[model samples]
Target: MAKQVAKTNAVRLIEQQKIPYELLSYQVEEGQPVDGISASEKIGYSYEYVYKTLVTTVGKSQYYVFVVPVAKELDLKKAAKVVGQKKIEMIAVKELLGVTGYVRGGCSPIGMKKLFPTYIDESAETLDFMIFSAGKVGMSLKLAPHDLVKACKGNFADIVS
Candidate 1:
C-alpha cells in the first residue's frame, strides 16, 4: 500500500500560480539522510537537477533564501556579496521552522510565511527545470526553473561554488 502525502504550502502555491510540476515521493525511514543529494539518488534524478533551499541571515533581522544544486557548496563570500551584506551564515536548525515555516530537510523556496529576497544559482539557468523539496521530507517537486524563479520572485546569481 502507498501512503498518501498531504499537500504542503509549497505545492499549494505552485498550483495557485498555475505552474506545472511533477510530485515525487519516496520512503523515509528513521535516521536516513533526506538531504537533497540523497534525495536525488533516492528519486533517481541526476544530482545536477536537484536543488536545495537554504536560509541564511544577515545580521539579526534580514533573511535571504538561496537555491543551489545539491552537489554544490554555497560560497559564503559570494553569497554575502550578492546579497549586499557584510557576512551571512546559515540559520541554526532550531530556527528553520520559525523563520522559514519549514523544517530543515523540507525547506522550499516557495510559500514561506514571509517573502524574503531569493537567489538561485546561475547554474540552474542552463537547465530547463529542476527539483526541490515540497516543504516536506518525503516529497519533492520538479518544475521549470524559469517558472520557479517567477513564482518565487528570485534571480539567478553565482552564489555557489
Candidate 2:
C-alpha cells in the first residue's frame, strides 16, 4: 500500500477551489535544513519551478505575502512599491506563526490566518507550473502559475532581486 499524504490547509483550499495540483512530500531529518533549494532537489524539480513564500509587514499591522523563485531574493524596495507601501520589512521569524499561521520553511501563500494581499514574482508568470510549500515543511504543491495566482487572488510583479 502506498503511504498516505495528509491534507494541509493549503492542499484543502486548492481542492475546494477545484484547482488541479500535485502534492509532493519528502523525507526530512530532525535537524536538517529544509529550505526551498533543498526541497527542489529532494523533489527532483529545478529551482525555476520551486518558489518560497515570504511575509512582510508595513508596520505593526498590515501584512503581505510574496512568492518568489527559490534562487532569487525579494527586493524590498520593489516589493514595497508593488504593494503601494512606502516601506516594508519581513515579518520576524518568531512572528511568522502568529501572523500567518505558518512556521518557517512551511509557509504557503494560501490558507493563511487571514487573506492578505499577495504577489508572485513576474518570473513565475511564464512558467507552466510553479511549486511552493504546502503549509508544511517537506511538502509542496505543484500547479499552474496562473491557477495559483487565481486561487490566492494574487498579482504578478517584478519583486525579486
Candidate 3:
C-alpha cells in the first residue's frame, strides 16, 4: 500500500481554490538539516525550480513574504523597495512560528496565519512550474508559477541577489 500524505494548510488552501498541484515527499532524518537546497535534491527537483519562503518585517507588526529560488539569496534592499518599505529585515527564527505559524524548514507562502503581501522572484515568472514547501519538513508542493502567484496574491519582482 502507498503511504498516505497528510494535508497541510498550504495544501488545503491550494485545493480549496481548485488550484492543481503535485505533492512531493521525501525522507527527513531526525536532526538533519532540511534547507531548501537539500529539499530540492531530496525531491529530485532542480534548485532553480524550488523556492524558499522567507518572512520579513518592516516594523513590529507589518510582515511580508518572499519566495525565491533555493539557489539564490534575497536582496534585502530590492525586497524593501518592492514592498515600498524603507527598510526590512528577516524575522528571527524564534519568531517564525508565532509570526507566520510555520517552522523554518516548513514555511510556505501560501497559507500563513495572515495573508501578508507576498513577492515571487522574477526568475520564477518564466518557469512552467515551481516547487515550495507544503508547510511541512518532508513534503513539498509543485505547481505552475503563475498559479502560485495567483493563489498567494503575490507579485513577481527582482528581489534576489
The candidate that wins on lDDT is 2
Q: Which pairs clash inside model 2?
A: none
Of the two candidates 1 and 3, the one with more favorable lDDT, higher being better, is 3
Number of clashing pairs per prediction, in order: 0, 0, 0
Taking the tens digit of each residue's C-alpha lDDT, what string does model 1 give over 83-132?
Answer: 99889999889999999899989899999999999999999898988999
**TM-score per candidate:** 0.95, 0.98, 0.98
lDDT of 2 at 2: 94
How much lDDT does candidate 2 score? 0.94
Relative to the true structure, how large is the alpha-carbon lDDT of every model?
0.92, 0.94, 0.93
TM-score of 3: 0.98
Angstrom error of the Cα, residue 78, model 3: value is: 0.2
Task: Give RMSD to native, each candidate.
Answer: 1.3, 0.7, 0.8
If both were scored by TM-score, which would come out higher, candidate 1 or candidate 3? 3
lDDT of 2 by residue, 1-161 (tens): 99888888899999999999999988999987788888899999998899999999988889999999989999999999998989999999999999989989999999999999999999999999999999999999999999999999999999998
Candidate 1 vs 2: which has more lDDT: 2
Worst 10 residues of 2 by lDDT: 30-39
User: How well does candidate 3 score on lDDT at residue 84?
Assistant: 91
lDDT of 3 by residue, 46-156 (tens): 888999999999878999999998888999999999999899999999999998889989999998999999999999989999999999989899999999998999999
